[model samples]
Target: MGAKMLAEAMGMKALLYANWERLELAEVPEPQPKTGEVLIRVGHVGICGSELECVVQRHPRRKPPLIMGHEFAGTVVALGEGVANLSVGQKVAVNPFVVCHTCRWCRLGKSNICERRQLMSMHRPGAFAEFVAVPAENCHPLPDHADTRLGAMVEPVANAVHAVRLTGQVLPKRVVVFGAGPIGLVCAQVAKAMGAGFVVVVEIAPERLAVARQFADAVINPAETDFLTEVQALTDGEGFDLALDAVGRSQTRRMAVDAVHPTGVAVWVGLHDDETSLSGMGIVYGEKRVQGSYAYTDDDFAMALQLVVGGRVEVASWVQEFPLDEGVEVFWQLARGEARHIVKALLRP
Candidate 1:
């Protein structure tokens, strides 16, 4: 708090470019913590789709020249003035989305959706660098027995937890999820843990379909058959009690809507390119419900962490790791729909 602590390591390179393409490596700077902030020595940082989006085009919020990554697991290395109950070398998982708590959404117990919320990589410098400064209160200390990778994933897992938990109040009902990506796959597992009698996941890719099959009651490949037909067949033509769209495509979003039973809930968690056409009358006869879910609550993060730590859900099995330098290749492949076997990718700094 007295002075900016600059890392004096001569020529120690950290993040080259906040945008990966330039490969513009920058000199490592010792992070300075403002009041109530902590400088975390990041252990692991995951490359996410949001980071890819920022890199792929003109990011509306990105100021660039900053490191890119939101998911991070670290040890508290330094604390700002007035920080308490925390010590150096404390292992913790950061809630990177720093929210302006004075907002309306924050007051409604939805701070994750706060209008002024600036997610780590987008608004603040992120974990793509060696260290990141975040609010001390945003971190949750890791359990002694938890895998450190699980800590880095708490952020993304929170999204999956929110998407699944918002479906309905029902228990022990059939559920179908579209696109077995990380979120979709995780949502499938969460739904089952929340008492879905049978959780089905649909993926067009053979590799992803196989991965989903490992944890889901049924995995349907739309490449070989009509997805809507397959979903109907699995749900016995009554459609699933709940349907979740994780791919974010117009067709898949509609698929999630169409796959739900009469009066069932359809949760849209996907972000897609095109606006989809849906039948208004289609939902009228069924009394189906559709809604979009964003970010997550602290409770969702806690539940997702517990599931991973308790061995009730296996995230490690679906994970793939990539070094920071491989950022460009990874994003290109992911953008082109490559990396079929991978549900999640970890970017190590």
Candidate 2:
């Protein structure tokens, strides 16, 4: 069916992952954006780390048979009549998290962690399908020179935005990022661009560690040695100034705590499956501050776009494009860890 016809069409198939068990394509009704919303013709949609957990029935947010995809970029094929500023035919990226604009946190310019949020892929139909209907306010115009594929990355890069800004230009400082996944590697590059003295990445996956070396000052595989001991020795026994736990497990989180200097800061960006414990004694004696980060805010997305525009964080090599039909196979392969060579994969429609 034509793009326009599909937008107006009453029925279509939305990919569903029933709480991490299995993903099945289902023929269902098409969705129309309400007033103040816009309908996009999805072109390039990417699978995320969270999606993997959702596929395996590990993530808490993956509801039964929900249309999944929060990372996407497409053209505004149709607009709900009440919407303004964005027009049909305009290319845009969808920042899927919708926060209440009137909250105190929002007023303080911290809406990404707002109390009330309506996020896509969790509460509503996501962009993995051909079309997505979202609030017009969530749409962002893409750079004229930017590829639709770049859309898949903006969400993750926003995290780098928070990472770079959180430390506030603590120059000549060393930074370590745990987990060589997309967010970790991207944050490493952002730290370098922001003028960190040294940036290191730690991961267990050899393949992902290789990619991390491409962008980080150093890459360490924890399996080969005691990563914490090595990190302290590498920093002359003082440790790094900033440590990030991009890997959500309790092990990585503890590693982050042990890898920082006495007064250094550690940021927790990973979502974990178990209750995590902090070394209270370490916090008191070490004076280490641990902060938690979540999805991007609008300001974070804006900063990420500028970084891409300035050629600070290159994402051209991070994307792996596949036909939409291969979505199931590709997802399964990624889950089994066979797709290590592919950093991020997009389902091209």
Candidate 3:
């Protein structure tokens, strides 16, 4: 056998998406880093809501027979040829969004919307495995005192930072966030950290609501009370200065628009639904502004790291860690919505 074939014979454990709604622990060939890339031994990898959605919904973009994990931190074990900046045994967080720098959006510093953007789990092999090879530039160094497991959260926090930064509210007072999932919880905390006087989180799940209380100023169960009415009462009928929808359902999207005052900003960061219906006349008449937040920019990612390292964001209170071998069972639990108490789940490989 040739040298490459010999390497392919050596395998590593991974959580492989064999088919829709099926995650299996399988041994796969370890990856080799190409030029300008580095091979990393994953320390901890987060299971994002989007990955669960892809499995339950069988998303077309994320096909089967894939390794699906993007939020992760690991140590560089091997560097590819032509790589110079990174060294072996260095701890770092992975920014899963890879973009072509020549694209117009990239040139404009909007690499998230680059014409040729590729996400780790979707466009290439991801960090669910024992080893993942990523572009050298995509790795962000972690501080000596930083916990490697917390590094996995940097990507998601960067997402929250990007969403909140888009609102342009320097000191928003009366901010309401919809949903108490990882992104929503983080969004509420980010808003508060950014000087929001009052931050309320709306969630229907009691378990999630219980967790939200730690990060949000107030927690509301909309199923028990009227959502808009409570919003009006909370803001004294003026509505919130900024409203964020981390749940992409039609109702939450509409509520985000309705919950914000005229001239207030509503930022949508969820990807639950592709099509949503909203009151076009209400938006135009009320002069409300809406923005869609995708992934994060380099600056946003850096800020996320700062927030995490500086103790501005919470990590251990809600996130649960599981051995990589348990990923199959964890994936099933998350997909079935049975693990409501686990706001964020990470796999230690």
Native-to-model Cα distance after best TM-score fit, residue 251 in candidate 2, in Å:
1.0
Can you write out model 3's per-residue Cα lDDT over 1-349, one digit (the tens) per residue? 9997997788999999988778899999999999999999999999999999889889999998999899999999999999999999999999999999998899999998989899999999999999999999999999989877889999999999999889774857889999999999889888878888999999999888998999888878989999888888888899998888999998899999999998888899998888889899889988999999998998899889889877898887889999999999998898898887788999999
Model 1 residue 255 CA deviation (Å) reads 0.6
Per-residue lDDT for 129-227 in model 1, tens only? 667888998888888887558788877777888887786566538888888877887888888787888988888877788888987998887778887
Cα lDDT for residue 257, candidate 3: 92
TM-score of each: 0.92, 0.92, 0.96
**Where does model 1 exceed 4 Å of error?**
1-12, 16-23, 336-338
Clashes of each: 4, 2, 0
Backbone steric clashes in candidate 2, count = 2
In order, what lDDT does every prediction score? 0.78, 0.81, 0.91
Per-candidate alpha-carbon RMSD to the true structure: 2.5, 2.6, 1.5
TM-score of 1: 0.92
Cα error, residue 286 of model 2, in Å, equals 1.6
All candidates in order of lDDT, best leading: 3, 2, 1
What lDDT is reached at residue 140 by model 1? 86
lDDT of 2 by residue, 252-292 (tens): 88888889888888888888646788889998898888877
Minimal lDDT window, size 10, model 3: 164-173
The number of the candidate with the highest TM-score is 3
